[model samples]
Target: MDTHDLRLLANRIRRRDLQAVYEAGAGHIGGEMSVTDLLTALYFHTMKVDPAAPLDPNRDRLILSKGHTALALYVVLSEKGFLPKEEIATFLQHNSRLNGHPNRVKVPGVETNTGPLGHGLPVGVGMAKAAKLDGADWRTFVITGDGEMQEGSNWEAIMAAAHFGLDNLTLIIDHNRLQQGARLEDTNNLAPLPPKLAAFGWTVLEIDGHDMDQITAALSADNIASGKPTCIVAHTNKGHGISFMSDNVAWHHKVPNEAQYKQAMQELENAQ
Candidate 1:
């Protein structure tokens, strides 16, 4: 799909995500909205995966490191045909496989069970290293929130990725600048992330996270360094696509009221 189509898909995903969060009465909606574009570009345009062969050995791997936004991932998976769209209504329900965090065993497209911050990159590094050792062509991609970047484990994984020359690995940081209860700057500022990742010996690309063209270009493997991992610092708003919620920290896990829900849906529809 082209960038225009991708944007439309992303808007649709955002609408569905809003509905899911409102229906479930709980979700990391802010982060989900922030990261929806990245997820859409990956599943719809960048990644090489067959929904019918979910376990295909050569398929590209995507680990949603900031897994609280699993609702967004689930919506993308459903749109990509990994699961039935109707199953989305069961989100956060008792006995539903579509839990708050993604589980690899229960979800077809989920590569690893991720919820605890800072685990996905290490696992992605391992996956990339394995592919390298086996001379495989498949790649591994991991998306983590800016708040999650404070985890020392992610830096360790970053260092290790460089040391191992795992160019097949790509890490996209959703730099929404907000966490659960406060702005990332107010909690633990990790600004100017590009220099830090570049100092660690990775190729860094910074771009407006919501721009589908920029997102698709950044994700392309054409100009990647041969022996260095790539990090795309995707600068994004916390609650993207909605008028009142954009960049609002309070929306992190807040359930939208009926009026708020209607407004959010209208905004997304207008964007479409």
Candidate 2:
């Protein structure tokens, strides 16, 4: 899809995500909203995957490292035909397969079970390295929150990825600048992320995360460095697209009340 269509789709995804969070009475809605555009660009325009064959050996893998926003990933997976759309209503409900965190074993499109802050990148590195060893053309992509970067494990994975020359691996940081309870700057800031990644021997690209064109361009395989892992510092707002909630840390997991939900839905509709 082109950038315009991708934007519309992202808005729809945001609407659905809002409804799901309100219905479930709990979710990382702020982060979900912030990452929707990146997710939409990947599943729709960037990744090479077949919903009919979710486990295709050569399919590009996406690991949502910041799995607290699994609702957004689930919505994208459903839109991509990995699961039935009706299943979205089961989110966080009793005995639902769609839990708060993604489970690769149960969710067709999910590559790894991720929830604990910093595990996805390491797993992605392994996947990319395996593909390299097998001479496979598939790639591995991981998205982590800015706060999640504080985890030392992600830095270790970065070092390993550079050492192994896993150019096929891409790490996209959702640099929204807010965590669950506070701004990232107030809690262990990791600003100037581009320089840090560049110093680690990775090709880093910084862009407005919500811009569909920029997102698609950054994710294109043609931009991959020959022998260096790629890192995309996607600058974003915490509660993107929704008025009143944008960049507000309190919305991290706050359930929208009836009035708030309606307003959020209307804002999304107006954007459409």
Candidate 3:
């Protein structure tokens, strides 16, 4: 898709995500807004998979390692035709398939169950390695929170992905600089993230996480430098697009009050 179309789709997804989060009475709306553009750029512009044939062996894969942001993924999947957009209203409801974290077994497009930090990259590495072992041309992409990087498991996965030469893997860090409790810098800082990934034998690309064109280009197959895994550090704003909440630590998981909800919904609609 062209940049204009991508932007429009992203805005629409953001609006839907906002509505879903509001109506469901709970969701990680802040992170969902932050990652909407990146997810839109991937599912609509970069990834190769038929919504009707979600499990097609040759299809490219996406793992939202920041699984609390599953609502964002669900909105994208709905837009991509994997599920009814209306289903999003059931988010976090008891027994609802649209849980706070994505479950691959229960959801069509989700590749794995993810919510805990530091788990996505390892699973993505396994998927990429499996593709290489099978001589398949498919690629695997994963997006994780910046704070999630503090998990030792991600480093372990990073070492394995590099050592195994799983060049088909692309890891995107949602470097929004804020975690639920505080700013990344105030918490366990993972700042100098690019240099760290580069030192691990990965090709590093930095881009505005909210820019569709840049996100598409960075995720394109040609962007992967051979013999190395690819890491795209996506600089983003937590609670992006919502005026009162953008980058506000309180919004991390804070439920929006009635007035705040209305304002947030209006802000999202205005973005369209």
Candidate 4:
């Protein structure tokens, strides 16, 4: 898709996410807003998957490790026909499969259940390893929060992936700089993250997470280094596309008031 078309589609998905969060009365809206563009670029522009056959073994895999951002993934999945778009209205409602965190078994396109931070990369490594063993060409992509990197398991997986030469794996960090209570720098800095990943023996790319063209370019398979895994540090805002919440730490899981909701909707609609 062209940049203009992808931008329009992203706006539509953002609006859907905004409405779902507003109606659900609770969600990880901050992270959802930050990562929407990355998810849009993947489902709409990068990954090769049939929404009609979400479990097709040969299809590329996506694991949302920061699963609190499942609302973003849900909207993207719906837009890509993996689920009924209307089902999005039920997000976080009682008994809804669309819960606060993605459940791989219940959700069509989700490859793993991950709300506990730092789990996605390891699972992605495993997925890539499986493909290697099976001689399959499918690739695995994962997105996690910068704050989530504080979890030690990610480092373990990094070592394993590098050791195994899992070049089919890609890890994108939503480096928004803010976490739930504080900025990543103040809490536990993972800054200079690209160099850290490189030292761990992975190929590193940095980009504006919300830019479709940049995201697409960085995600391209040709960019993967031979004999190494790929890691893309996607710098982003905690609450992107909405005025009051952008870069605001309090909005990490803050429910928007009615006025804020109306204003956010207007901002998103105006993008088109």
Alpha carbon lDDT at 258, candidate 3: 80
- How does each model score on lDDT? 0.96, 0.95, 0.90, 0.92
lDDT of 3 by residue, 60-155 (tens): 999999999999999899999999988888888888999889999999999989998888989999999999989999999999999899999999
Ranking by lDDT: 1, 2, 4, 3
Cα lDDT of model 1 by residue, 143-261, tens digit: 99999999999999999999999999999999999998888888999998999999999999999999999999999999489999999999999889998999999999899999999
Give a tens-digit lDDT track for model 2, residues 188-263: 9999899999999999999999998899999988889899999999999988989889999999989999999999
Give the clashing pairs for model 3: none
lDDT of 4 at 110: 86
The digit string of per-residue lDDT tens for model 4 on 185-240 reads 99989898999999999999999998888999999999988889999999999889
Candidate 2 lDDT: 0.95
Q: Tell me the lDDT of candidate 4.
A: 0.92
Clashing pairs in 2: none
What TM-score fits each model? Answer: 0.99, 0.99, 0.98, 0.98
Root-mean-square deviation per candidate:
0.6, 0.6, 1.0, 0.8
On lDDT, the stronger of 1 and 3 is 1
Q: What is the lDDT of residue 254 in candidate 2?
A: 93
Clashes of each: 0, 0, 0, 0
